[model samples]
Target chain A: MQKIVPNISVDCVIFGFDFKQLNVLLVERKLQDEKTGETLIDDWTLTGYHIFEDEDFDTAAARILKGLSGLDNIYLEQFYAFGKVSRVDSPKDNIWLKHQHEGFSSRIVTVGYYSLIDNSTVTLQLQERNVKWFSITDLPELGFDHQEILNKALEKLRSKLRSEPIGFELLPEKFTLSQLQKLYEAILGTTYDRRNFRKKVLQMKYIIPLNEKQKAVKHKPAQLFIFSRDVYERTKRERFDFSI
Target chain B: MQKIVPNISVDCVIFGFDFKQLNVLLVERKLQDEKTGETLIDDWTLTGYHIFEDEDFDTAAARILKGLSGLDNIYLEQFYAFGKVSRVDSPKDNIWLKHQHEGFSSRIVTVGYYSLIDNSTVTLQLQERNVKWFSITDLPELGFDHQEILNKALEKLRSKLRSEPIGFELLPEKFTLSQLQKLYEAILGTTYDRRNFRKKVLQMKYIIPLNEKQKAVKHKPAQLFIFSRDVYERTKRERFDFSI
Candidate 1:
């Protein structure tokens, strides 16, 4: 007898920064099913896989990240579970039909996780066919309900960035204030007044001004600031009421 | 070819109030393993079922609530997903392992939802065998990981009860201030100074006095209050911060 097991899986939307734009790691699908045999489809999708019977959700998420990005020791957070019956459509059927399943049909529940990583540390060793990074704002049409998943992840990222110092994950160990502000703008998808933003940052008392400045730039190099873990923890514990 | 499908399911922990204590609904298991012909142990568990392939998570949650509680149009929120591998120990090892190529190892992921309802409305219809309500503080040992699930749900309910007017769900449509305070005390699992608690309630400006008193009480009946939805919404939208 074949045991029918409810399949659990985890999908990670790893967001990285390239100093100019926020990008996400995606993989292209190689359609080999009979319905889409030899069909040249250029669909990019988030890196995900079925949870093995022995694996936990967090373990599955970590394994997927390690296999796809070749990075370890990264922080990942479980955000939401997607259980829409028709989230994954077969290639032969209409794209919209993917989100509709018949009575008691096959179902896949995906737990979404978001991770912030420095693209510079991402080794392309696990780069299989069609693996690439695209600017989050310029993402092409992706397979399944990945677009919705990405949108949710982006929303969580923005909310977290507003109250938390998660932007450090997207920056180098040492960075200038301009680069940090640019990263914030990319994630928030809006611009802030530079002077006002700087004033707010200084008031937060978490960003420490270093004596060093960036070496390269046509204009005068701006001083760099490093995030203080001590102050970050203190601010988080004290719960200062600041809103963006 | 036989199609193998994973069963999706939702379980709800319906919290109710009885003036002084918080209660949850539970049902005893009845299925017996065909091979052993032994009665499925007298293990009480939450009401749950496999999801129809086409149903959304919320839809499935509501369906379960209606089926078990005989109440519709109640408020339910999804809390956590229980996906442990050994959540269900196989009861049919002797029967299925003899002929089955793949053993009875199956993974079931259950999404937990918590609902608040007036205990008076829970018409105990279609109770299988040993269905009953247990006080949250006096719960018996439950089967599976239900104990952990209940703890998590209780935590969410307690945190939400402070900021939102969810206590109204536990109380009757019209309730005295003492009744409301009792619900909060039960949920918070602590005692509060009556005068201070009353002061805080007055400051909120949402709980309006109904100019009525309880008919049966040892002491002079306290004034009744009805939760104002408009004021609650406006307060929640503006400066809504609760930490307890």
Candidate 2:
């Protein structure tokens, strides 16, 4: 007299910053409709998966990351869940529905998680067809509500960048203040006063000045700064209020 | 060549306030393992599903709500996505890995959404097994990281309750001040000085004094008060400091 449980799944939108633009990892869907047999889609989308009955959602996400990108132990955060009925559109009715015989019609609930990683370090396994990085500003038409999911993740990322040290995960270990400024500008999607940006960062007392300079640049070589370990550790437990 | 896309899903933690306790809806998973052939394990969890290939996550959530709970067009908020390597624990070796050949091995991402519903209006559809409510304070052991998901949802709910008229969703259309106060107490989970609580609520000007009284109460009949539509609408947009 037990009830049949619906399948659970996870999807991730991984964002990376490369000093110039923000990018997301995307993969093309391989499966075609049983009826239409159309394999081509408009644009690629983020990586995703189905949840096993015994596995935790977080674990499923990590497995997706490692399996697709060969990266493990990176920071991944859950952002949103989508559970609309008729979310899936197949050419045939009751075809996929037959897969799950439990009275419940065919439906899907996808949880969205995002992560910041050094895109350069990501060694793509490319198990399927194509795994590529798409510029956030120039993304093609995505499948499902992924565009909305990306937008939400970007909003969260921009908000978190101001308060948390999440930017470091997207950037290289060492970076210049101008590079940092550009990162903020790209995320905020607005040009910031360079002096004001530098002043605010300096006042925070968390950007440790490194005795290093950019090797090659057209303009003046700016001094490099690594995030202050002490301040990051202290603020790890402290809530950030970046209400400027 | 086209790419293979993993399926997407969404799960909801519908929270309800019963004036004295915080409650969430839970359903028992009915499917038995194809391999183990064992009956139900002690894994009770949230209601969830996969995102259809054609639909968005939000739409999917609304569909599940109607099909499972018989509620339509309720307020639902997307909270987080759960993506981890080991989130799903099945008898098979990482459900995705076991099905690695079918392109289904790729990780599944699930988006978590929550809604605040008036429990009184909810007519539980008995299509599934047990659709029961459990007090947040006294929830039995759950499957996967659902407990953590509920915790995070509660955190968001508590923060939202402080600044918005979320309590109205849990209360009857026409209610008494004491009843509204009880809702606050349930959400806050702390004792408040009745006089102070009343003072703060009155000062907010969101509750309208009705020319009616509670019927058949053991003690003094409390005056009925309707939530002021105008004030609630306006204050919802203006953020209120709720640090207390």
Candidate 3:
């Protein structure tokens, strides 16, 4: 066994963004009833683990995401540390833990991380088996303080999306303007006026319009565009308003 | 004793922004060399605590600020979590912990928080003796991974300062344009063209110019202005570019 630190864990909220909808990767956990002695299954949780002594938190969190989603290369950004003294084990939690493991001792402090990944590329099967992508709208009951973690992740995602170019991380990259607008609408929950949206996108020099067109569409083909990271690198400004 | 989870703590990087210089609140920690048995003193550290089971992360961090800085009502924003597996009791760290307590167990994950407070209004005397404010430019040798923590706090503070109207937190309510420019220069480590800086400041509608002038100065008095939060709330844009 790796020299994992006791009572300290890293939890990841993996946000998957497709043009149509936003979803998060949550693992389904199996537990047993202490009083009834019956196995209960399918309790959802954010993928997590206690880091080993030699491991950095970022590496540990990335490992957890890779193991749960069966994909690599997605960079994880830590958003918060959920360290309420009772986060891991309370009397009520202990009763729940009795079904999860042999025993419960001290509480665990969880550091939360979040990353945006392209949902279209992820596999349907997870290595640990029951983990699945739940759309942000139809989320199920989650174990521990996972629901709180998920909410925090959403808050950060929305805030980060507004001020940054992370939109490309969730998209197919060479995508149409309509698809870009749809992704923004789905995440922000607000519809932008088509004319105004197009105007704003056109003015943003970093979003380069390509010569290619949507080939498979039945309607008039829409022009495609890609984000220019090089231009953004050269032009990033100090806006002087960091609310999010 | 209150139910506190072992091996988790909250460290505050209390930034005091006086118009002239950027300062941080650090507590003096005393230690004894395990090999020499000689008392070592004046090892500066950030003010922090292991959270009680009853307290939330926000509450715990706020309590730390109140206890050490004796200032309340100042908003504290958590920026990052530092959780390397051996953060608490590494062999190099164990030598120092020998003087702190009988022994250190497990590992402590410290959640880092930062806040901008007006240094002029703050009372110097603290509940914990030897707590002192040191200019960020002239920092002393800090205990533990506090130097790392302080660096992270500085990074966050600079980012936050660039995008928000938090400059007021570091300046007197009524301040001259020169003072404002100097505050930005000190934090950002860059010089601004006085004409361009004044032009930009004049264009920002939220920076309300008062009929006041600087007093008790040997030099010619300059015009004073204050940041208007109300105007900012109403007029702040969704500055679509989120690059630092």
Candidate 4:
């Protein structure tokens, strides 16, 4: 029997990019009535579970993600914790939790984590699970305050992308400037002037231009670039600007 | 009788700037033996408590801070959640919790919030309580996992100051460029070139030069400056740079 913390849970909003749009990994949860043993509701939820009795929150988030989707070693940053009394107010969600355990606690404090996935490798494992990736532009009605959680995750992702180079986590190792621009636009939900964006990005020393180009393309191939972590580490400044 | 969540706690690391140094607010906790009623241990701890049953994490944090230090309306940002099984591994902390309540559970998931206190106004209220501010450079032996929690809070504060203008929260409304520089140096624990710092700061349109000058100082009075939130908001960009 798995010993779990009754009052605490961890949810992960896993984001991925596919050269065009950013998507989130979500699991389909089917709820059933305890007495009838019949399906009561079916909806999507950010992959999550109550923490093990002896596990820390980070460990619990990683364990839950691995258990649900078979994704290992994927770093998850805890961005927020949702503890509103009304988090599980929906009748169906309340009933579902009560049915899941003998004496389930409805008042759960969920630690929210946002993770970025390198889609090229994790796609195969995700395809084998009972999970699906939904674009941030179009999302289904999520269960148990998950819509709010996912929205907060996207907001955090946008803010993080503005200050950090985490956007590279979602793109291919070797990508074109247009692909990079589209990934930012999709996540940020705005279009940038192509030339200006390219100029700004090219000025960044860490983005190294590879002596390579896209193959088998109808249009003229664009130069490929790679994000060098070593250069970023060396050149990063401990800067505090008046950019509130 | 106060109803509280047995498994969830909220800790606030309240930081303040005293012109020359960064300080943190902490409470002195004296634990006694349950059976003997004799003091068993005495140590300092971050101001915190198990949240009330009907409250959210933010509400709980604010309530705890208000109840303990008479501080109100101070915004506390949730920086991290600590949920290690051994967070209360110290025998004294375990004994203290047991003494505080009957049948108390030791496995607590603490949501950590870092609050910046504008020392000028809140200092008087804090003087009446058991709480005291300690310099970040010289801290006492903290109880439970509080030292770790406080360290993490400082790390968060440093990183936040590096990107966001939260340093203003720790400064006086009217401050000189030297004071601002000192505030950054005190928190970041690094000195900056005076000319470069002033040049970079003057270029920022938000930090406006006031027609005011320092009074009653040991050295020559410096020109005062004020952080203009309106200007910052109006001129802020949604630009994502490859800094790291």
Evaluated with DockQ, which candidate comes out highest?
4
Q: Over the stretch B80-171, how does candidate 4's per-residue lDDT look in tens digits?
A: 88888888878888777776775457788899999887777574345443678899999988999999999899988887787677888887
Ranking by lDDT: 4, 3, 1, 2
lDDT of 4 by residue, A1-244 (tens): 8787888889989888888789998888786666899889788888888888988888988877776557788868888899998898897787667667655576888999988877766743454436888888888878999999998988878877877888888877899999999998998888999999998889889999999999999999999999998898889876566453
Model 1's alpha-carbon lDDT is 0.74
lDDT of 1 by residue, A1-244 (tens): 2222345568899999999899999887645435656564557789887776677777788888998878887878776678887777565324323323322224567889998888898886556467888998788888778999999899767756665578888887888888888998888877778998777777767788999998868999989888887777765532212111
Indicate the residue-level lDDT of B3 in model 1: 28
Model 1 agreement with the true structure over B1-244: per-residue lDDT tens digits: 3222343568899888989999999887555657998775556678776676678788888988898878889989877777776666555323332333442235667888999888987787665467788999888867767788899899767755644567888888888777877888888887777887777777666788887877888988878888787776665532211111
All-Cα superposition RMSD per candidate? 6.6, 9.9, 4.1, 3.6
> Which run of 10 residues does model 2 chain B get worst, by summed lDDT?
B235-244
Looking at model 1, residue A188 earns an lDDT score of 81
Look at candidate 4 and give me any clashing residue pairs.
none
Model 1 TM-score on chain A: 0.84
Per-prediction TM-score, chain B alone: 0.84, 0.82, 0.89, 0.90
lDDT of 3 by residue, B95-139 (tens): 656655733355667889987788887886655467788999999
On lDDT, who's better, 1 or 3?
A: 3
lDDT of 2 by residue, B1-244 (tens): 3232354557788887676777899986444556987654545688776555556667777877777789997878877666554555554424323543545434455567888887889889988487789998888767656777788778777755654566777777788777777777777776667887777777666777888888887989988877776776665432111111
Number of the candidate with higher DockQ, 1 or 4: 4
DockQ of 4: 0.55
**For candidate 2, what is the total of clashing residue pairs?**
73
Q: Would you estimate the TM-scores of all the predictions?
A: 0.70, 0.57, 0.82, 0.87
| Model 4 residue A127 distance off true place after TM-score fit, in angstroms | 10
Q: Identify the runs in model 4 with alpha carbons over 4 angstroms from their true place.
A: A29-43, A98-102, A123-130, A192-213, A220-226, B30-42, B99-103, B124-130, B193-213, B218-228
Q: Is candidate 2 or candidate 3 better by TM-score?
A: 3
